[model samples]
Target: MEDNSRSKNRREFIQSGMRLSLALALGSVSGLALSKVVKDEYVWQIDPFECTQCGRCATECVMTPSAVKCVHAYDLCGYCDLCGGYFKPDANQLSTAAENQLCPTAAIERRFIEEPYFEYIINEDLCIGCAKCVEGCTAFGNGSLHLQIIHDICLNCNECAIARVCPSNAIKRVKAENSYLIKGDFSKEQES
Candidate 1:
């Protein structure tokens, strides 16, 4: 009878241990799943490293004005008075005249910082994401002006229309924190 009682207790103890193990295993899986969900949060962005300065970003976006906009990495900028992103190739003068402007929309505004240093500002309201400035910047100056998806203006479509037709295959869903892939000193630029 004592042996029977001991055996019964042993069975109960084993069962309790198994139950606790099962619970722990289930809890671990749940925790892992939750972490994955949080880590996988993604957003649509243009990979400037892969972008070829194609004109499609302007026309292919579902949004009328398009979410893609030229962003200047000031740290990467040469601050040249004859900024390639701001001025046309054959521009006779280094002035703010419409004829001298590379951007058709006049979205890029040049501000005089010093004698030779100038600041280029993108007027988001007027920008059409045409890549004219981007192309010019890449060809003539340090590639400070690159295209990026303006999250505030983006529709965040389940499947981005621009991504489908992207010739360089530069547009895609990226983890939220890794979205803006700029060419140079990207981490430094993000700190500010």
Candidate 2:
């Protein structure tokens, strides 16, 4: 009888140990799976297509110089001797005169890369996001010189101020890795 009782207790102990081990193993597996699922849900992406070119990106941004700035697309650019974005539409002619330039701050620097090929560079410090240059580019030149949100100046807020006031419903939060410079469908080839 005593031997039987001892054997019964030992068996019970082994069974309990096995159950505990199985539970621990299952718990760990589930925990890992849950973590993976959560990680998969968290991905970053920005939709440059949605940007409305609203001026808020210039002021509401936390940075001194708003992260949003105009970028020149040279590939789609006509490189015209007279850049519409640089020169005022009413200007007498395509001259380097400050009065004739559309840019309020003279941020667009025009250099003669070659005949009929002018390279337009933006001085970011002077850019005000007035969209004057973008408007000119879109109207007469290639749809280059679009506005982009610069990450370095962006606060990366949970809710972007520019996103709220955007008339075209542009401005989307994307992952940090894929944050900016997405020229989707703009067709402007990157300049070398």
- Quickly count the clashes in candidate 1: 0
Q: 80-106 in candidate 1: lDDT tens per residue?
A: 998888988899899998999989999
Residue 83, candidate 1: C-alpha displacement in angstroms? 1.2
- Give each model a TM-score: 0.76, 0.68
Which residue pairs clash within candidate 2?
44-175, 45-174, 45-175, 50-170, 67-150
Q: Which candidate is the best by TM-score?
A: 1
Worst 10 residues of 2 by lDDT: 38-47
- The parts of candidate 1 lying over 4 Å away from their true place are 1-39, 187-192
Clashes of each: 0, 5
Q: Give the runs in model 2 whose Cα sits over 4 Å from its true position.
A: 1-54, 184-192
Query: Model 2: per-residue lDDT, tens digit, 1-192?
Result: 999999999999999999999999999999998786633222222244555455566676656666677877566677888787899999987778898999888999989888778889999889876778877877787767778776656666667766777777677654555455546333343442
